[model samples]
Target: MANAHMRKKEPDKVRRSLLDRTAKLAVDQGPAAITIQAVATAAGVTKGGLLHHFANKQALLEAVFADLLKQLTDEIDRYMAEDPQPFGRFTRAYVRAAFADHKLGVRSPWAALSVTMVADPGMRRLWSDWLDGHLAAHRATDDTPLLEIVRLAADGVWMADLMGQDRAEPRDMTGLEPQLLALASRPPSA
Candidate 1:
């Protein structure tokens, strides 16, 4: 019983440490440098120690992505909790967070890691599935073009940043926040 409990606790600690290391690597040098050995070294662990928790580099990267997804999901949750009346508040918060200061906020990790998907379709699929689920859950209330537009606009901003576009201006998202709130808060079509 003691050994089992220690095994459980130790793995969680190692897993968290590896994730923190990977996120730092991702932010610093981008996800392309996120390797099992690299993360192990960064986390002050041996490769075998990292492998004990992740089994492989792909698994570690997935955990990194999972960590980012959870953060974004939690952000959404907190925003929703503040105003549970209509889902618009959730949507508005998303836009504000996404484009606030013309930056992707904490979601910058997702954009950085997204490039790795070209080398790993499974990672791409995982992200796609998560996005699909979110859309489906909102489809009923969204039930119209407004939600689709928001999704597209949000994606456009990301893509623009990814492509290094030099638009008229970065985005001025702060100015657009109120417009997004108005659109999302409007009563759904009868």
Candidate 2:
């Protein structure tokens, strides 16, 4: 029977799909585009189905933000895992991930959410919380002013690219990572 091949509905799968679509919408249309009707249409699910997974639009937005942050933290961890050196390691990984995310163009949730993160206090608080956690964890290695400057520079470059600034792209500048990593690699002054 044609109907026999159909798989049973899975809530987890459906929920993940909804989240993925929400991120995509944010990437394509900014956070303001994220609504119950819009996300449902994007996810190809019924309004009721989307609501089942997310009780409201605000809940859906928070879930999307959480999902994006998880993906970012995982990438940072992955990058950190590959580097043997402890000094400037997190900064290096963040630089790489920031530039790499930019290359993904409109599909990268960070690109769209950057503005929202700055515009919305709740989103900004989440971002600040993430930074606070990482800062606490890496204080031993990343407490120096030099490391802080490097991190701030990386943030600037990332936001610049997102804002469509000419010549803001790291790839276009040539050896940007090497330069940033060079600074990050230097040991803190005694």
The TM-scores, one per candidate, come to 0.80, 0.87
Instruction: Write candidate 1's Cα lDDT for 126-184 as tens digits.
Output: 77887777767766555467856775676666555665534555544455556766777
Alpha-carbon local distance difference test for all models: 0.70, 0.80
Tens digits of per-residue lDDT, candidate 2, 63-117, equal: 8888888888999999999989998888888888877876776677888777777
Candidate 2 has a TM-score of 0.87
lDDT of 1 at 183: 76
* lDDT measured at residue 61 in model 1 versus the true structure, 0 to 100: 87
Model 2 lDDT vs. the true structure?
Answer: 0.80
Task: Write down the RMSD of candidate 2 (Cα, Å).
Answer: 3.6
